[model samples]
Target: MKFFLTKSYKLFWVLIPLVFMYGLFNKEHSLMVNIHATYFVINHLDFAGLIVIFFGLFGLAYWLMDIFNKKLISWMTAYHVFISIFGLLILLVFYDEVENLEIDYAFKQTLILLMLITAGVTVAVQLLFPINLIVSFLRKKKH
Candidate 1:
């Protein structure tokens, strides 16, 4: 786990497969919407693009992690990566439920609110990057 986060290229390699898997997912969803008429009204591209953007930002962050410093607070990377992924999973799951569950509108609205909050938090957590950088740059010399 430590190596995964600290080694940017290794993590990037991991991310590539995830991105491709997501691409296949989107392709399947696209087929459903087009041929099967699945009634899944979610903009398939937007969701796919969301995943792409997520990976893109992570890749950039990890690369910067390499450039700015080889080390990071292990817990910080763990929290950021896990929570961001968790939030994205929640978003995708709730989106599917809200769209396809055939539940009450009120329940769906609640789900939407949850989605909104999760997204806000997911985005907010990225603020840690700059925070980490500030601390990194501001540190006094060991000499």
Candidate 2:
């Protein structure tokens, strides 16, 4: 339980609000987020709200996987990767249909863009630890 409140988890909690603020101030829509103002961001997504949600979810996943395998972090990464891939597949298959929808065009587009970003970030996070280890090992051999 205490482990779940570490810096890494806090950092993720921070991202939800940073995203919301970005959405609010981004007049040009350059940030390109999918969050519905009335449905998602305004109600369910705040700093405290997201922290509780992620903390509970991660803690549950971590402990459940820890029971069978000790590699909780690896499993978490794998889980994120799997979900991100699923999101990408949905986006790819339904993109044309979504784009052609008559109503709420901007909202739909923003949602698709958000899905792309989530997929990208999840992949990057999963890869980063392994990539860093490889880079560090190569550097040590060179020295």
Candidate 3:
């Protein structure tokens, strides 16, 4: 259990999955489609909101790549957490425009907020929990 909380393990299971989920959401939202159709360009808020979402998705992909390459060391995880927070902040900053989309905006906002919170919580757990207990225990030879 504790071994799973280590930087490498957490990077694989937690951070990677979170970033993948972010990418999934970004694709599902079809932000590019909205922009190309001009639905997001009609207003300043919408344009800015769409831009933020794109940046967030970009950051998420970058982070995921880092994890996939086994490059997310402990310090890197800290950076990744900040990036995730920034992504969340971008969404929060544009909440008003996001809430105005044609779909059930309220539901969308709630889902995004929940995902952001869960990502944050997972990072916290990865950092705070005993990460290498299992590995350490296994390394101890029996008498």
Candidate 4:
């Protein structure tokens, strides 16, 4: 339980606002147009809201993992990765709608790039870190 409330869990608290700002100011239509191609409405606030909620859920998962054992942490990490990837994909599909909503193109691009970079880093960390930790633990156990 104590682990669930650690600094790492709190770090995600900051991301909630970032997701909102990114969705609010970033153009989505240009990105979504290529994917949807027709009749997609841009809902900036709604998308931002969803991102916030997802982040909250992830935070809770982290908390639960922290309260449990190493096996639980590994499972939670996998769950977080899965959910985050799915959310990113959904956002990508509708990104062009943000442009249609009158957000500045440059700002939109910057936000998209930031989101992509963050997602990439997260995926990399999630995939490598846990496996490495588990392997290290196993080796230590053997010795």
Candidate 5:
């Protein structure tokens, strides 16, 4: 119910190394994260590899919120974290070696569509961070 900046950022910081390590040691060896403009390509639709960049941004966001001494809106932070973790889990559970394996065409298309939608939602959620930062910078600090 109540999420704080410390919890929000710590969640991401803890995930960063795990994601980096996963991307590093992944057997597919095809996980390419182009954080260049913030896009990822994995085999076919391998998306979990992007978690490193995603989580790092979150950590940075939370840290910035703290630096600005802004009080986090608990529900907002909780929803953001929940959506992200849900998206991540969906990719990890169903997308492994998907391109290599011969699956049904309809199923593949549906899955791809689902993945894309989820990714879009996740990215959209990140907009909250910069907005949060700007608002925090502008408004008076909370007690």
Candidate 6:
């Protein structure tokens, strides 16, 4: 249990798979979506969501490459960059649809809360995983 919680655990590699599965199994009534119709609506940002899933798959491939070639990690940064770029592009293309979204006040609040919590968890996981990698590298050098 402690090992799983620490920055040194290989379990950190689970991030990519989790991201992939989250995207693949994304649901209409998912806890992640406060508005059930958000993705189903015409001109909605479904393609952007698909891009995010592809980025996750790429991240997993990047990790596998890193296992064989350590330099790949230094060359390829976070996979979220791809997702962020495509997400912004999609938002730009669907600006009117997004702006005209009719989510209720309570649903909007819930969405905001969920977004905050997810952001916090993502940050913590990112921080912890890097610490694990750094500590491992330093220990190797010291030895």
Best by lDDT: 5
Candidate 3 lDDT, 1-143, residue by residue in tens:
22322333333334434544444454423332133347642333343444445445534543443354422234444444444445444543444445555778678867657655654664454442223223323443422
Answer with 3 or 6, whichever has the higher TM-score. 6
- Please estimate how well model 2 matches the true structure, expressed as its whole-model Cα lDDT: 0.43
**Residue 45 CA error for candidate 2 (Å)?**
36
Q: Could you give the C-alpha RMSD of every candidate to the true structure, in order shown?
A: 6.2, 12.6, 12.0, 8.3, 5.2, 10.4
Q: RMSD in angstroms, candidate 6?
A: 10.4
lDDT of 6: 0.41
* lDDT pick, better of 1 and 2: 1
Off by over 4 Å in 5: 1-6, 31-50, 88-96
Error at 46, model 4, angstroms: 1.2
Q: Which lDDT value does model 3 have at 50? A: 44
Candidate 2 C-alpha lDDT tens digits along 1-143: 33432223343444445444533443232212244564222221232343345444544543444343333343445444345334433433344345556778789768667766765775565454455334434552321
Query: Cα miss at 129, model 6 (Å)?
Result: 2.5
Best by TM-score: 5
Could you tell me which 10 consecutive residues in candidate 4 have the lowest summed lDDT?
27-36
Clashes of each: 0, 0, 0, 13, 0, 0
Candidate 1 structure quality by residue, lDDT tens digits, 1-143: 76666764455446556755665665545312222454445555566566667667777877775776645666667667777667766665455545566778899777666777887898888777667656656765322
Which window of 10 residues has the lowest lDDT sum in candidate 2?
Answer: 39-48
- For 100-133, candidate 6 gives per-residue lDDT tens digits of 4589878756655655465455444444335434
Q: Summing lDDT over every window of 10 consecutive residues in candidate 1, give the lowest-scoring window.
A: 30-39
**Alpha carbon lDDT at 91, candidate 5:** 60
lDDT of 2 at 120: 73
Give a tens-digit lDDT track for model 4, residues 9-106. 46456677777776677534234322345654546566567668867766665555445432333444544454464546455444454444467779
For 16-94, candidate 5 gives per-residue lDDT tens digits of: 6665666555636553333448856564223445676677777787787777778776656776787876777566545
